[model samples]
Target: MPPGTPFTVVYELDDECALELANKTVHGVCHLGWVPAADGDYELRMAVLVKPNGFLGRLYMAGIKPFRYGLVYPAMTRQWESRWRNRNRSGGARPR
Candidate 1:
């Protein structure tokens, strides 16, 4: 997970199958969460609190939003899906 910069694991609960990461960057702090979906799949959600230093920070966030969602996240999901399918086929062993 390209979890932005300066992130730490804020909370995790394997029993609940949930995890959260808080990222503090120059522009703002973003809290990202991972939770199991109804069908046993996982999903990622994010909440952003922007305290932009100036106009630049706001602009930066706006500029990156499309790139992150349109490109980065889709690619990451594909890779993750591939790995997951491969791992399952291999009986939980990671392929080298």
Candidate 2:
């Protein structure tokens, strides 16, 4: 998201949807997808498919994988949950 190409909607269907973007820096293609659980809660997942041009790209990804998984992703999930709660309190549209 940092000065990267805008995210484009990749797929939309009853069960799931995804948005993907290409970065200009160390990262390559990335996508975040959402699907509904059997219990009626939504589950989110992110995938980073690397097209590492050289050693640097690969190293960068490896170095950041821990931080990404441990910090960034969990924070993102919490933020999403908070937003959903706020929306529900304000009578926002039902989360699909």
| TM-score versus the correct structure, for each prediction | 0.42, 0.53
**Candidate 1 lDDT, 1-96, residue by residue in tens:** 334634444553322112233334343444444457788766555555555456676677678889877886577556644544455576663322
C-alpha RMSD between model 1 and the true structure: 6.6
Clash number for model 1?
0
Top candidate by lDDT: 2
Model 1: CA > 4 A from native: 1-5, 15-51, 76-96
Error of 2 at 80 (Å): 1.6
Question: RMSD in angstroms, all models?
Answer: 6.6, 4.5
Residues 1-96 of candidate 2: C-alpha lDDT, one tens digit per residue = 224436566774433345565554443444454567799887665666656546777777788889988997688656644554465577765556
